[model samples]
Target: MFIALIALAVFFDFFDLMLSGSVTAALLTSGWSTRELNVVFLSVTGLGGIISNLVAGALADRFGRRRVFRGALLLVGLGTLACAAAPRMEFLIGARFIASLGMAAVPGVGLTLMNELLPVAVRGRWVSASGVISTSSLFAAALAGYLLLPWGGWHWMFIIPGAGCLVLYCLTAVLPESPRWLATRGRHEAARQALSKMHIDEDGPLLALNTLERSGEAPVDRLFTKALVKPLVLGVVLAVGFNVATTGFLTWLPMLLLERHLSISNTLAYNLMMSLGIPLGGLACTMLADRISRKAGIIGAAVTALLLAAAFPFTSGYALIGTGFVLQVSMGVLSTLIMGLYLAELYPTNVRARATALSMATVRLVMVFLPFLLLTLLNVAGVVGVMAVVVICLLVIVFAMFLLGIETSGKSLDRI
Candidate 1:
């Protein structure tokens, strides 16, 4: 039940993230928005994400994971509800920005809580497993777009996830604070009580607490010190590289297909077919997450994705869909390892959320400019040119993983 709840949190995060692609495509087809307006919309959403990630990290570190998680859900719910009722492109963009404030932070907080709560030996697998559930959201979004876009239009897409988030917010009341975080803050009794909720014995909590380094200095300040700075930098590099590739490829997929002369229905159909790889990639990560070093997994998956991306521009019709499916699978593997396991494992309990959020903030910061960048690439050199850029980002990821990646598989969160 505990893992399931965390999985649901991750599911909604990915669901919301994936919706941007579908909603933008629908808006374009419906004549409600133009390409230029879409760029502004995406940029504003990214801006909101940047602000929310930093603030959410500090709040999670200062308050408790459970509290911040619930609060973020409420914000996402309210903002998404506003989006559903938006009357114009301008209002939708504003609502999307508001939704992003909460939407951006959900997965990071969910992963952090899972890292803190789960046992060390099984942590990577369970975290990756949650990603299996989360990645399915990609397929869910695609499926939703295919069904709802033609019949009910884009409004249903926002309405469903918005309502779902509100229900999930209420359900989060059953979640416990992170025991390791409590222990680091010197709240031993509270830590033990949290442990009890997990059915962990008192001795289990005591032994876990013994290994934790107590909180010191401001969590934000400690992030830049020598010991933490390396991982922090690595985290930022990996995140930026991944986001550049994904935000460029996945978010722009439908538009790219449309530019190829595919009709809206055909474009969405291709997307639905390609999205199948998301869950498959997550399943692969679940199988290999604990069996191999995360560094090895990231490098391998990135290389595979790079190869697939290079092949993308050369394929047509079913061939294009096949290449994309394989690419999504490879990306799915990278996503689970990097976001679900590697980033959270790099830091200790006290500063984990802040460190993760800081790295993620870089992702959003890059996102702010990506719409313009990708638009320029698409217009200048076409999809081939756009893919060349994705190829470059993947190459960077592979090089960085080989050079700076740390192995955290099977290591205790505190020990790392």
Candidate 2:
């Protein structure tokens, strides 16, 4: 039940993030002018998201996770509503960034809350299982955009997720705080209050965690302490590495496909087909998360993604579709399963949200300008050149996992 609620909170974020590329394409297909500015709009919105994550992550730590999480949700709803009502390309672009600002914090805040409340032994699997929910929503949203754009157009796409967010915001406005966060702040009673809300048995190992209350140390300062620097540094690098593939590439994929001589309908069709792997990879991660070492799984996923990405130029028909399926699945592992769970597990409760944000911020920064670079690269080197870059980035991910990966398997968050 607790996990279900967290999943519900994440649903809109997943939907909104995946919708950007399709939305851009949809707007173009609908005869909206200014094709050059669409990429800029996407980049600007991504920039807004990065800024929001950095601010919200720290604020969630300083204030409270539940409050910050709910507030972010409300913001996303507002952005979505604004988007639906946008009168022109300019208004839609501004509305897009407004929505991104609020939606940015969901992953970090949700990860912090989930890792803090759930058992350490099954934390990886539980988080990965939650990816099933998120990725499913992503696929659904993308497919919905694909189908709806031909009929009702882009306006309704925004409305669906926006309405979903408003309704969910109303329903889950008041949720339990993270007990680990409460304990980290030395609020024992508040910690117990959190547990009571979750209905977690009081006799569990949660109470056994030592609440190390260090006064006066800033949250960001704590993240950079000697013990955390390795994870922090590697996490930020891996975070950037991960984005070069999914958020960087996939976000621009629809337009890229159009550049490759595919029709808009065909582009959406391929995307709808490729999106099948989101849940497929998520489901695999759910099964393997606790069973295999996360480090091994991450390495494997990167290799798979690299190989499939490299094959894009040579294949078509079912072969192309197959590669696309596997590519998205592997990317899903890098994205939905590993990134969030890995970052959250690397930190203690006190600075977990901040660390998660700081790490994710690196990716968002890369992705903020990714559209411009991607367009330039496509013009100069074509899709194959872009794939080469993606391959290099995946290599970086593999090496980062080897050097800085922490074995969090079956271990408590406090012990990490």
Candidate 3:
């Protein structure tokens, strides 16, 4: 079941990861100005992702993780197909947004569900294991774009994920609702049955008991209350900052390389190198997050990202390309480390899904504006100048960590 759930999580995420990159090159060639469309697409995709996050999280809390999880995959499939058949830029933008909604749920609900299923002993490890899943999705997207583009064009991108999602929907019938969620809603008997079936021991009862111990009435307000003011702000602001720095850097990487005289094929190869770095980073973070601090992992990653953003425009030839690859690898790990652990740590099981969804939504919102805004900034000041600004932004993230962020390396969601 753990393996099956992980597979499901990875499959859906792979589909989402490729949507933007696969279409990116094609968009540049579609006679539409890639710059403007990228801005619109990034904005719409991020906005849509957040909306889906909220919808999926709330619905999972209300309906059950299995139901919403399966539904999200179905939506991703349909949305991908929508992208494949979209005729105009407007239609493509809308389709991407729809896809964002579906993609958004896999993180918020899927992570929450997985954490609930696993024991604390291996929770951080298991969560970090999703890094491999994310890495595979990213790699597969790159392979699909590299191989299929010459044959069927860009539509194959969406078609493949759509097909995969259809298969996932069929397989989803066997997955159980999250036991924690069931217990939280007072379905103790049902929750116990589910746990027993999975051979899970009743370690500390469930979240319901924890809630009872904390607040005799309810913690309904804790999700948005003063006690959690720090976490709430930290989650949104960190996500926004990270997305801006990462996306702004990645979206313009190839162009920056091109400016330094690398060919298209060379740039693609460089990108593949960067993609390889993501999982390695995730693995490192997974190992360290449980031992050190989640906040430290984020800070380390951001600082590295800042340095890489600066280095890309200065070096040339193999050094420049090598540095780009290294930067990407670190950024990928940092992103997964922070997003997977930190965001999940910010909310309880009851509002975990909602809190995560909102954080994801904020990232998407940043994506919408950052891509366009950064590009314009680049046009005005060239690649070096643009990266200098990003360095400052990344510095701000480090400062935020010291001020607002809490350590959640080995903490449980209920306590966090």
Compared with the true structure, model 1 gives a TM-score of 0.97
Model 2 residue 38 distance off true place after TM-score fit, in angstroms: 1.2
Clashes of each: 0, 0, 3
Candidate 2 vs candidate 3: the lDDT winner is 2
Expressed as tens digits, the lDDT of each residue in 1-416 for candidate 1 is 88888788778767877878878877888889988999998898789989988999988988878888888889888998898899999999999999999987888888899888898888888988888998899999999999988764788888878888888998888999988878778888888898889998844533454433664225467888889878888899898998889877887888888879899899899999999898899999888899999888999999999999999988998899999999999989988998888889888777888989999988999889989988898899889988988899999999888888888888887667
The residue ranges of model 1 lying beyond 4 angstroms of the native Cα positions read 202-212, 216-219
List the global CA lDDT of all models.
Answer: 0.86, 0.79, 0.70
Q: How far is candidate 2 from the true structure (C-alpha RMSD, Å)?
A: 1.8
Top candidate (TM-score): 1
Cα lDDT tens digits, model 2, 1-416, are 76767777787778887887888887777778446778778787778878888998889888888788878888888898888898888888888888888887876787678777787777888888888887777688778878888774788888887887788778775677888777666677878877888777662466565536333125466777898899888788887888777764577777767777888888889888888888888888888888887788889999989888888867777887788788988988877556657878877777778888988777778777877787788788878877777888998988888888888777888787
Q: Write down the TM-score of every candidate.
A: 0.97, 0.95, 0.90
TM-score of 3: 0.90
Any runs in candidate 3 off by more than 4 Å, and if so which?
30-33, 150-152, 212-221, 258-261
- Clash pairs of candidate 2? none
